[model samples]
Target: MKNYLFLFLCLLTQNLFSQENVDKKALKKEYFTTAEIDVKPEFPGGGEKMYSFIAKNYKIPESKEKIIGKIYIVFIVETDGSILDVKITKDIGHGTGEEAIRVIKMFPKWKPGEKNGEKVRVQYQIPISIN
Candidate 1:
């Protein structure tokens, strides 16, 4: 009976510890949007290179209406420096927003953001213009 009780207690303790670890992992996956982070994520070769990449890769969809405005793309820079959840927060019509998303998705991994000296996932946004 004592041995059974000891085994049960050990199992219970392990379950609790496992639960804590799961919670920690969930927290780590959460992306921060606030400007309070110690460092912001950046492109590998800086803003100019990023823009150049976009200019080289961005494809404007042929539209009868002639799309001519700025679209905003938002995404999460993961702790590992890869991007996730690409979205167009604001956009002009004619497939421009989707084009922007595609260009952003093709981008290489960025320098991950940091908070409290630890690498963290961060929300980032950029604007693209269609002429």
Candidate 2:
């Protein structure tokens, strides 16, 4: 009888710990934009490196007329510094929008923004110029 009681108590303790873990995981985090953040997200190597990456990776599509314009893109920098939800706000023509998106997707993870000393997700915008 004593052995059975000990086994039952161990099972109960294990179940309680598992339930606590599940509860913690159920708390999903929310994302915010730079307008709402105290600290802005940054590229791993800073702004200059980000621009250099774009300049090196961006390729102008073949077209009859030279494509020269700017493409605006917005993406979410998550709490873990991974990018998500990339969108193009403005696009010129000749596959410029797609090219911009492709290049942005190639960007490495950035330093996540912070709010009240905690890492937070932030929406970031960038304008790519094609000439």
- Each candidate structure's TM-score, on Cα atoms with residue i matched to residue i, is 0.78, 0.76
For this target, which candidate reaches the highest TM-score against the unseen true structure? 1
Clashing pairs in 2: none
- Measured with C-alpha atoms, the lDDT of residue 20 in candidate 1 is 99
For candidate 2, write residues 35-111 as lDDT tens digits: 88889999988999999999999888899998888899999998888888899999998999998889888989999
Q: RMSD in Å for candidate 1, one decimal?
A: 3.0
lDDT (Cα, 0-100) at 1 in candidate 2:
100
lDDT of candidate 1 over 1-131, digit per residue (tens): 99999999999999999999999988765788749699999999999999999999998999878778899999999989898999999989888888888889999999999999999889999888777
Root-mean-square deviation (CA) per prediction: 3.0, 5.1
User: lDDT values of the candidates?
Assistant: 0.90, 0.90
Span of ten consecutive residues with least summed lDDT in model 1: 27-36
